[model samples]
Target: MATLLLRFLLKAALAFLAVSVLWVGVYRFVPPPVTFTMLGDVIGGHGITKDWMSLSEMDPDMARAAIAGEDSRFCAHHGFDFRAIGNAALRNAKGGRIRGGSTISQQTAKNAFLFQGGGYVRKAFEAYFTVLIEALWPKRRIMEVYLNIAETGIGTYGANAGSIRYFHHDASRLSASEAGRIAAVLPLPKKRAAISPTGFVRRHGNTLSRRVATVRDQGLDACLR
Candidate 1:
């Protein structure tokens, strides 16, 4: 019985590894139509809205804004930012609601491949997928995919979808400030609105706008360019 169980477990492990590798490899070239987050929304009967746009199809300003707002060191890091992770761990150790310090690459991997939230098992998958994407996909592709799949609002996904729903404009035409607002809400999209100027969002958007310029001036966003 022990021998039989070991064989079954070994087979299952191998199967999982193969599927994970193949799936990540396929998406390196292909645009993913849906993600685990989108699937969850659909299963919960909340209709999903997403319109994938290529990196060039959207405004460069939007990309810069996302970088400034989300991860200013995006171009400098490999797959993870150890400094940010250390800071996050230190903060959590002090006791509070646990927060994440995931980089753009990590978020891209999670959004594209894994589910929204799970315990250690999902985290292990996230780490595996993050490494796969960083190793397999280019930085531009990573940035592009992140912008397109990140949840922007309730039931809304992607830059194009969020732009149309919020500002009634195309993603390519978003002004720096407009793009800033969109990027500002990314951390908590469900509770924030890009169009309406809440005190926090408005201030945060302005900060991102200035940071976008700073990033450009310093060439901190050179990877996307």
Candidate 2:
């Protein structure tokens, strides 16, 4: 009985490892066609549309804008940014849920591995997969996955799809301002339209634009370096 139990455990461990390896390999090579998103059901089951854009193919401005808008400490962190997490915790303790400290790596992991929800189990899974992705994939790959899978519009729209739907252009052709605007809508894509400029959207877009310039002036290569 002991030997049988040990064999079962070993097989389970091997199966888990194999699944992990397969997930990383598939994400690295093949672009996913569809992604699950919270907005899908909210918007009448419209699937989240995604377009695969490689890091090499995207403009530096787009990358900088993304980091500036989403996670400024993205280049420095591993899977999670403890500072942001602490800040978020403090806010929550004070009876506020002001900010989300999800890093690019964490977001990538969530988008790729789990369903969206606000629950402890989901969050735990997010953290676990975030660590795995950070260990298995490069920083560039993480950002690429995030940009592709992140919910950028209300219905059946992702980054590339949102870009085309709003600006009438591809994500690769997006200017800094356009990219900033797109990133700005990320926090409230379902409730807001990317093309329509609300006060909050405009403010966020302007803030992102300034940060993007700062990122560029400091040199994007410097962050990676």
Candidate 3:
């Protein structure tokens, strides 16, 4: 009986891994209709507004703003930013706000495939999926998908939806300041709305706008270019 159970578990694990790899590969050239996060919203009884935007359909400034606001070292890292992770770890040890230091790759993995909240098991799966995406998808595709899938507001998902709902503009026409505002709310979308931002969010958007110029000037965004 023990042997039979072990065999079944192994088979299931293998099947899951195989399916995950194939799924990541397929999404390299294809857009996913929905993601696990969207389903989670439905299960939570929150109706979501999501509009898929290709990288080209999204303004280049928005892409750069996301890179600046989310992961400044996005072009240099593989799947994780060990330095930022170490900083977050030290800060968590001190125990104030308990901030997380997830990279864009890790977040893309979670937003696209996994659930919210952090646990050892969820993190393990997140790491595995992050590796899958980083290895299979280019920096551009990763950004495109991230922009399309990241939750931007309550009951809202994706840049296009957020842009239209908030600024009354399409994502393709988002100005730098508008893009910066959208990027600033990513960390706490449930709490912050880009349209009428709090003082902190407004300042954060300003900083991200400056970082956008820095990333462009430093060639930190060369990977996507």
- Give the number of the best model, judged by TM-score: 3
Per-residue C-alpha lDDT of model 2 across residues 17-126, encoded as one tens digit per residue: 78977887788767655555644454665544556677677666677878897788888878889999898888878984478888878888877777778699989878
**Positional deviation of residue 221's Cα in model 2 after best superposition, in angstroms:** 6.0
The TM-score that candidate 1 achieves is 0.93
Model 3 spans with C-alpha error above 4 angstroms? none
Clash pairs (backbone) in predicted model 1:
none
Supply the global lDDT for candidate 1.
0.89
1-225 in candidate 1: lDDT tens per residue? 999999999999999989988988898888898988999889999999989899988988888888887777898998888898898899999998686788999899889998977988988888888888888889999988999999999999998899999999889898888889999989999899999868889999999987878888999889877
Cα RMSD to native, each candidate? 1.7, 2.8, 1.4
How well is each residue in 1-225 modelled by candidate 3, as lDDT tens digits? 999999999999999999999999999998877887788788999998988889876888888899888888899999899998999999999998877789999999988888887689999999999999999999899988888889999889988899999999889998888999999989988999899787989999988877778878888888888
lDDT of each: 0.89, 0.76, 0.89
Error of 1 at 29 (Å): 1.5
Q: Evaluated with lDDT, which candidate comes out highest? A: 3
